[model samples]
Target: MEDKFIYTDKERKLSYQILDELKDTLDKSFLENDLPMLQVQLKDSVAKNTIHRNVFGLNPILCSLQTAAIAVKDIGLKRDSVIAILLHQSVQDGYITLEDIDNRFGKSVAKIIHGLIRIQTLYQKNPIIESENFRNLLLSFAEDMRVILIMIADRVNLMRQIRDAEDKEAQHKVAEEASYLYAPLAHKLGLYQLKRELEDLSLKYLEHDAYYLIKDKLNATKASRDAYINQFIAPVRERLTAGGLRFHIKGRTKSIHSIWQKMKKQKCGFEGIYDLFAIRIILDAPLEKEKIQCWQAYSIVTDMYQPNPKRLRDWLSVPKSNGYECLHITVLGPEKKWVEVQIRTERMDEIAEHGLAAHWRYKGIKEEGGLDDWLASIRAALEAGDNLEVMDQFKSDLYEKEIYVFTPKGDLLKFPKGATILDFAYHIHSKVGNQCVGGKINAKNVSLRTELHSGDTVEILTSATQKPKAEWLKIVKSSRAKAKIRLALKETQIKDGLYAKELLERRFKNKKIEIEESTMGHLLRKLGFKEVSEFYKQVADEKLDPNYIIEEYQKVYNHDHNLNQPKETESAENFEFENPTNEFLKKNDDVLVIDKNLKGLDFSLAKCCHPIYGDPVFGFVTVNGGIKIHRTDCPNAPEMRKRFGYRIVKARWSGKGSSQYAITLRVIGNDDIGIVSNITNVISKDEKIVMRSINIDSHDGLFSGNLVVLLDDNSKLNMLIKKLRTVKGVKQVTRI
Candidate 1:
């Protein structure tokens, strides 16, 4: 049977327009050969019904044309990326293959299509940009930087076309992903114009009210703003002409999203915002004289107006890692209002507009070393084996604003703003960060948490006794430090877990007991452990005693062997204690209602995860025919659900039970004078709460301790935690 072909008039019109545009813009060879071949293949695919429109009913051919146009005009991608963008869908739909593309176009084109196909497959599995999927997406981007550029261009095209789309939910999702994912990617790639457009478009859909408000306000003030800018620029123009410098000036207003951010950050309305616009002075200078001309213009502008010394930013001396080079300053303008001015040459302006693509073009290379470094850092974070941390590190690294610091030997290093001394140590080497006790900044002794400032000379202090601690994760700001700390902590946990496992096995052998892996697994599950490693980790952490585990294992093993024995002949009490003879709880309706007047069954709150009143909880039927209430988020709850799911039952507090529940709080703070006393004072001030015990440990100018307190419900416990957080020197206070 012949397949039905579908093509809309709009799709045909777009194709013709794009083909005409490509004929004018692209090389003759591409227009005559590649373009015609692609068109034929696309038509065949559509005729076969292999290529279908997206969920929004967007024609695939039209989408490809629009995305390729963006890649060429906006992102400055070459024929390879454009070809990949056009044919990836065909390759994905099985109308074409990677090998076919490789033979027809080139390996570069095929590789980009492969990356695109991988991302598409990932989206099919989980459309949400979550932890592991996000990492995979980033991996695809890192494989070929052009893939990222093309994807960003594609997203921009989609965002623009979907402005009046009927699917508001899908629009919102697309806009959110653009804001959260693509905008930052654009910014990181140095595509400032695209970044602003993405942000503004996202705001238009996501926060429609705020977007229109800012846009309307900007529109209303445009005439006056322009007149004022001219009045401010005329004299500078005349002076620069008199100085014989060639430059053009324009007034650029901030985007609506930028204005909205300013309103929120400054806590004011549009009228209250100063510097709503910036004056960009583009200089026409040769490559050799670009910086000279920029600085000369800077001098002319500062001479004309009273400049704010602190607002001066000199990126010309050391361009941003993304290859953005511009000198920015804030000067007092005609109305005594502060006005921001940016000075750059034509090449710098292009780099500022196009980002990494223009950088590669000017540098005569296909990629940049800085981007490779960023990708390397991302790989390191992925290897750290924490999905959440990888996601956090990925986003943070994407939107990082860097600050340069100095080593003791005059070597300069760059780190993200807010990077701590420990971050610097890690950047120097993993060993230094691990052994870092403190550091000397500008000849002054400082703690590991001290934030580094630009141009500060730093000296790291280390000792043989110093080691990485769990608290260091909170102290450092850079992803490198965080990843390194996580790896170190994981290594320690593994070692401890292995040692604990060995100790348990040796104990079993000493007791003349042969461990059956099946019985042992069942015992761990019954005891609320999902994984053997976790059980060993708990034992390693001293939360579960090895002797107690052995005793439980022996009982479970003996009971499993006796399962075939005559049940009627066995003692009822022993059977009840061993087998818990109650019927399995219904998944949906079974609930253990706890109240003061409860009767008929013995139950107690579990100690493993202190489930106080007002806390969401579940009940695990113990091996002794009694139910033990546990907080749903209790660490042991997973193991119980995984191993002994039959024993799991939903639970809730039916009434305000008059029972004091024991809760432990872990507090970490600076080891300051009377810090412990201050913590105790906060607890003492709480009249309804009683402190049962407090155990403190101090090392290397920091203190971490556990405080066990008795409270009636989660409310008092939360209140107490809040007060403890407010204590002087307290950094983190969390429930354990």
Candidate 2:
């Protein structure tokens, strides 16, 4: 092992040989379409060199794709499918482009590759990476159903490579990502088999101790269960075989995570978890009579093993929202062990495995609101504008439960289950939302944050000058409202600056202060503003009060150090940042650190890893000298905070955020009267101050709501609470 690498003869054969075929297949597929452009990019690489040299060495990267190609071929991938598979990782690695695929393999191949490319394994920086990644996967897949399919194949290949990862920590990281991000995605797409394997494989690394224990338990009971399942299926098998039918019957145990979750939930032992295993019967029914005949097979199976009524899930009738179909029933077997059985035709099995996407056989079949429809909606929305709306809708539609509600206009609006009227309002229009005063659900006045159920018709109330309230954020769920509220808050701050400037001009005229841009410029510079707009925005957002600005202007015009830079001895030195401030991220000077969590002190996870328990961490002194703690591994902490490590403090959660921080909320939707007063009433308790201001901005039939203050942490905030939480004519709350 030269670099201590353990690649063997087996690895060399499996990878190199397989990749050669994959490369040839891709070349063939691309050549079958346009040849010149892709050839040039391909030729850019010298022989014996790599196409994606930056990310991996020529051989190793190629070898990974080759393994994928081999697996694809085994699964009967065609030319476009194999080429797309080969090009998958390279796109994100920046070794190639969609244009390369289009030029070489034709538009169709490029489309397929693009679909697969939609599944993200790449990285980026954001305060909420998992939520953002989830957002991206949701929106991307809505544009191409094939993305889920490709992700499935990618997971398959990654699972196989798990054993080869030498680093214990690295293995766990990869496995945990697979467990949380990939496995759920597989389940959402209805790829049960892939879901099972991925969850099991991930669990092996993530909870290895638990995994081995579960494995041992299953192994201990394997023989007896196998014998009993065989006997249980024997009668049904004989009946089907006697009927000249062809089918495959097999049993599988639930994965470790599933069993663990069940055990924790039900407070049960392995023996108490009787339905941990299932017997699946795959039938050979034809397409036309498939549904009817599948029920017949179900009837036969039920007759063989007495079916439990409560445990029977008739998904075979309605099918899952993802288009998964199969008759699932739990039966009392001869041993009295509960046996779960699934009876489905091969087509149903395919659909069950692939979700709405598996139904498309070729280009000709007319799909019933198929994957293409969803993908088209996503792409169309992206192209149509409103990125926040697109991102929100994508997240709502992609990951979990979805519901559809109607507006007064009779237009059907789809939303995540438990979506608030605020979400609905933002869905309508940002301007209308900004002006949203209130709303009526089913013709009865309901809070803007009220969760709309299926078929509920909402009539939004609005006001032209209505402002977004801070409390609505506590209730709204959809990101649309959050985004709108944020944008509106920004826009309102600018507008308010303009308004303040007008007011100041009048005051200057009354006071006989000369009106000159140069004088204003000097005053602004004295106040430490980069531009007049910033000054105006501060005034508009109430970060600068007109009285303060006027007094400050007088002082600057008259030489005032009373406020600008107070003596170091002043208590204000300990007070940092704007009061009722916009939490804009910045690089600060004067590093200092303190643990708010010490005794009854307050602290926060310094925007990196949101340091939970057991994370290697450190603290950094910020300009405010307010101690900010970060995971020692935080990227920014290493760069900005580490130089002065003395400021960093060790932080652990003392339970959760006390009381919910009175953080202001932003809601944007339709504009009508009373949106402000209504929302205000919700969080209007005496202890809660409006702080700086409430902002209302509107444009093109949309309104945005913004409330600024301070508040508690996330779990305390929610959509339902947002509606009842308060805001007038509020459509949605957007957090900036």
Candidate 3:
């Protein structure tokens, strides 16, 4: 192989090593096609200026091919996968076209290569790829999972050789990609060794000192640690042998990055870490006895070593959501050091190592586990379409930890960690979740947003009045919960829109006006509504007042109808006012003084919210009435400002009034006896103030009430409220 190579000596050696690794797995047809393609790739590497090299100084095309080949062999991929790996980068670097690959390798290989090339272009602009970019890359190649396998292989190979590259910046970029993106991806795909190696190499390059320190510590203690592991496994090995179990046991140490993580999490040094080693027992058993054999292994190991009941994880009884099945236990070993022990059969170990791809490889076999359902859900989510946000959520769901919770009937259900009761209800059924107002976790009533933990018995509480709130979208973490909440909100919005449409039509009918499309369009624009449906939705939800539509319609109707009619004649004599502020006011016996020149004008205080003399007042001209005075901050001001700005006029006091005005005071205080009595005394003591009504409420050591009083001006009202605040037990007092 090396003698036929036209590239560098190192490249020839690496390519041969890759081919050798695959030789046992691949057949003769694949090998014959691979050699010619390899030669063509070498020639094409020079023909096209595919001369650009990665930081490792290897030609991009050759490096990618090697990486892809190594991954295919490790992943147990077949012929088309191997061919796709070889030509995946060929079409992307302008060395050859997709048509050429299709002609040479057939259409199956061409499609996979096409998917990979398309993904390459999506993130080519972003030099530093993160988990999000990886997700998009997955989506781009989701049509063919083989493309993703090749991509992950390409990433693994890059991380493997990144440290040797002279460019530290490129090394850091690749390290970040490995740690943040490819490592988790590998883990999801069930390539545990590849995942661990990617993570370790990333830590080695990203945090050099910490990596070396842990590495050196492990290396220095290797001999002593190996001896302890041997001593600990000796008893379990003997017991398993005596039990007639056909099994192989091996001692395994934790990865360096994993150990560093434990140190950071537990705030401890390396020496303080326990369970640094694990003994795995892989059994050779028929499918019928696999579970029994695994449990038997567990029993034998525990009998030999006193197992810590708290450290037992029985995944065999219920496999992880990712289809991971095993029984793990921590036991007291020799020298009192704790050692973890894993029990599984050969098939379980394969699934544990290879993930869903393993299931695909063994799909024709009857022994395939529960991965079919999980994969179905994953593929459904991926095929849901080109929604980037949903893809982000799907990516998050992939990495979510599985937590097993129980129902009131003791039925077990699995959910992501940090999933709320709302998520749980939705997982049961959409209707149950939609009507769920609260739930009882372990018989304690909790809100719908309460996060559930493992082993808690949950019972949902539903109400006919309960409906999904927009805020629920933020509280629920599961994609199902989020999707359901969004759907419920949208349905509610559409329902309200229909009701709003009816309400608007009824109002128009009552006003003897037709609901014309042209008029409605004009009305929506004038009211600042972008769409008619939005306006109707707001009206149905009671967020927008229907009166706004009627008022604006009337203005438009009058403007058009009066265009041809003669305009009304007016003179300075008709507006007889000596002072502008008193123009609309007529003299009255009440404390509200008015201008005598405006004697015939009909005027009154607006009752929606009373406007005192010192308050900022606005006069609105009514159809039959001369003027109505309202507070500037009145609730009706916004509608008036939008629909009838011309009807608004300024009004002020004549500075000659001595009458009293009623105002409401809201007061809160500590619920002490005689608190209300003290408040009344303060109000009554003011000679200029008159108390009209006092309402007091006290409960649970807290008192709140409203007081209505008459005062000459805002100054007097503010003074009275302030004096009431100084009373004992009073926390806050405000004029309403």
Question: Which candidate leads in lDDT?
Answer: 1
Backbone clash pairs for candidate 1 read 529-639, 530-639
Residue-level lDDT tens digits of model 3 in 80-111: 77777766666776778889888887777787
Please provide, for model 2 over 1-736, each residue's C-alpha lDDT reduced to its tens digit, 9 standing for 90 to 100: 1232334567556655765566675554444433344335434442323343322122434444654563344232445555566565556567777897676666655776665554342222111223433434344443444444455666566665657566777677667667767676667555666777788888777777878888899999889878887888888889988767778887877778799778879998766787878899998887778777777878887877788899888876666555567888888888677888888888877766544335344111222353434543443444443221222234323334555455565455667767887787778898778788779987899877678764466788888988776576766777778888888777876777779788888877887876655556677887898877777766766677666666666766555324455545768656544222213112212112235424323434565444433344566657774555566666676666537656656654332233333344667766667666666666565343333567878788787756765443443344334554344445566443
Score residue 586 of candidate 3 by CA lDDT. 35
Which of 1 and 3 is ahead in lDDT?
Answer: 1
lDDT of 1: 0.79
Q: Candidate 1 on 1-736: residue-level lDDT in tens? A: 7435578787798788996886677774363478778878877787778876676878878888899898888876667777888889888877778999999887778877887875565454333452332533354333566677788999999999898888899999999889988888788767898999999999999999999998888889889999999999999999989988999998999888888998999999889999899999999999999888888899999998999999999888877766678999999998799999999998888888877556544652122354445644543443453221232324323324555555776555667778999999998888888899999998999998999864467899998788788889988888878999999888877898889989888988998888898898799889988877778878888989878988888789879889445655766654212113423221111224643334335677788887887889977888888889889899998899999998887667644445676789999999999998899898888778899999989999999999999887788888898999999899999999
Shift of residue 40 alpha carbon in model 2, Å: 11
Off by over 4 Å in 2: 1-12, 19-59, 70-78, 84-102, 107-122, 126-138, 141-148, 240-248, 354-357, 362-736
For each candidate, the alpha-carbon lDDT, in order, equals 0.79, 0.61, 0.73
* Candidate 3 Cα errors over 4 Å, as ranges: 1-6, 20-24, 28-34, 47-49, 125-137, 140-142, 361-736
**Poorest 10 consecutive residues of model 1 by lDDT?**
582-591
